[model samples]
Target: MTDVHRAIGTHGFERLLHHLVQLRASQINRCAYCIKMHTQEARRDGETPERLDRLIVWEQVDDFSEREKAALAWTEALTVLDGKADLGALRARLRAHFTDQEIGVLTSIVAMINLWNRIQVSRH
Candidate 1:
């Protein structure tokens, strides 16, 4: 984990946003390994264990902030590719809190984590 952290370093710690996105995406992908690993990591990074436990039910939980909810929603929409992503709506909501560049980075992080979750779970 340390080596992976060192390798991904700056880009990896760019924001808490990416990590949260990865956690949510992993849940959507149903990757138990990633869910366990990232949830622990997220807790180490100061995310509350209670919040982490409720992450899979984020939509139904009021513990997450508005920005986090929006990110989670976007992650799910994009991951499921349900063709129902209201990009304009999501963008408008996100733009209120995040820079365009931040949104781009988050989107990339979600996509990458989703791919990782699939590859990891497939190996089992």
Candidate 2:
């Protein structure tokens, strides 16, 4: 996944956005370890305390950008697949902000974090 991160970073995926996606997915999965890890990493990378604190209610809050919202929405849709996930619409929204390759990278990031979240959550 480090390779995926590097690849995505090359495509303009900033560190803060990466942490945001990881944090959002971890939150959806209720993975305390990942949530803590990503939140700390985000802060270490200069993410504002206000944004980090408000990330749980990102949709209702006006703190995130359209791109961040799209990524977070995609992360949630992918993480909490309750058979009603609107993948097409989510992909469309992602496309509005990211290129096809970037979308692929974003999907990979979400999938990776979900995998980690499951592992971490299952351990407890």
Candidate 3:
């Protein structure tokens, strides 16, 4: 899981996107430690206060691009573990902005973060 996390940041999409993905998943999982850690990491990497503040309400804002919004939709759906989510529609949205390889990387990032969030949350 750690290795996959490293790879996700190092490849496919930008580091900012990776941070957003991880942070969003962590937010959904209610991992306070992760939320703090990822928020700081993202800010250190130049993510704006506005973006971080608006992250939870990203769908209703214009601060993010279509590509980012697509990624966020995927992240939210996966983190929420919604069995009824229309995955086909999600994939189509993702495909509009990302390649298959990118989508795979994004998926891996979400999974790794969710695992980490679970571990972190379980400790408390």
Candidate 4:
């Protein structure tokens, strides 16, 4: 219900992509509430059970596309980085698959979810 959540709803990303970002951010932040909430929302939006089950272990799963893999990597790196690291390869992969604006929006979406996860986890 926050502005960030409202922006996500308006962003025009595919349902699967949106949920995938949410799931990745939730996992990074260790938010069980968000994990459960997004998983259920993802299912309702038609994400397959197999994919959802494999999300936490996405690197070990072969179900994800190359672009998705790159995006996931980018998501984690961005969330956890402490300083300037060479993200050139990941950036290239993302650029090849996503428009510049998509990359920007996706980054913000992950950041926003992570922010929410912190709030939700700390308060409860």
Candidate 5:
């Protein structure tokens, strides 16, 4: 997992978006530890209080860019997946804002955070 983290870092994925993705996944999983840690890291890295506060309701807010929205949607889809996901539509939206590599990286980010959240959640 540590090595996977290092590889994801090499993609130059936007920092704030990366934090938001982590927060969104953590939020879905209700992982308190990750929520606290990620929010703190986001702030330390120059993310605003308003943005952090609004992240959970990002779909209704204008604080995020379209690209960020696409990523967040993907994060949610991956984190809270049911049997009826419309992955093709999600892929279309993602293509409008990201490269195939970026989508892959975003997928990895969601998967990793969900895994971490499960581990943290299980311990509690």
Candidate 6:
């Protein structure tokens, strides 16, 4: 998964956005280790404190761009995967701002983070 992220990073997926996605998914999964790691990485990558603080409430905030919002929404939907989630609509939202390849990478990022989150959460 780190290799996948490295490859995607080389292919133009912004590092800040990648951290944001990982952070958001980690938050949803309640993985403290991931939250801490991603938050530090995001800060090191120059993400704003305010944005990181408000990430969990991204939908209600004005600090995020349309692209960031869309990505965050997609991350949440995939992380939760409850029966009530509207995956089709979420995919459409993601398509509005990201290419198919970008979407695939974003999906992988979310999936990988969720796997890590579960592993870390279960160990404690």
Best by TM-score: 5
lDDT values of the candidates? 0.77, 0.88, 0.91, 0.84, 0.95, 0.90
Superposed Cα deviation of residue 112, candidate 3 (Å): 0.2
What are the per-residue Cα lDDT tens digits for candidate 6 across 10-121?
Answer: 6677889999999999998889999999999999989999999999899898999999999999888888888988889988988999999999988888888898899999
- Candidate 4 lDDT: 0.84
Q: Which stretches of candidate 6 lie over 4 Å from their true place?
A: none
Q: Tell me each candidate's TM-score.
A: 0.83, 0.90, 0.95, 0.89, 0.98, 0.93
Model 1 lDDT per residue over 20-100, tens place: 888889888889899888887887778887887788898897998888888888888778886666888987887887777
Q: Worst 10-residue stretch by lDDT in candidate 6?
A: 1-10
Residue pairs with backbone overlap in model 2: none
Measured by lDDT, the strongest candidate is 5
Give the TM-score (vs. native) of candidate 4. 0.89
Report RMSD for candidate 3.
1.0
C-alpha-based local distance difference test score of model 5? 0.95
Ranking by TM-score: 5, 3, 6, 2, 4, 1
Backbone clashes, candidate 3: 0
- Model 5 TM-score (2 dp): 0.98
lDDT by residue for model 3 over 17-67, one digit each (tens)?
Answer: 889988999988999999999999999999999999999999999999999
Clashes of 2: 0
Per-candidate count of clashing residue pairs (backbone under 3 Å): 0, 0, 0, 0, 0, 0
lDDT of 2 by residue, 4-120 (tens): 556656766678999999998888888899998999999999999999999999999999999999999988888888687778898899899999988888888888888888889
> CA shift at 12, candidate 6, in angstroms?
2.1
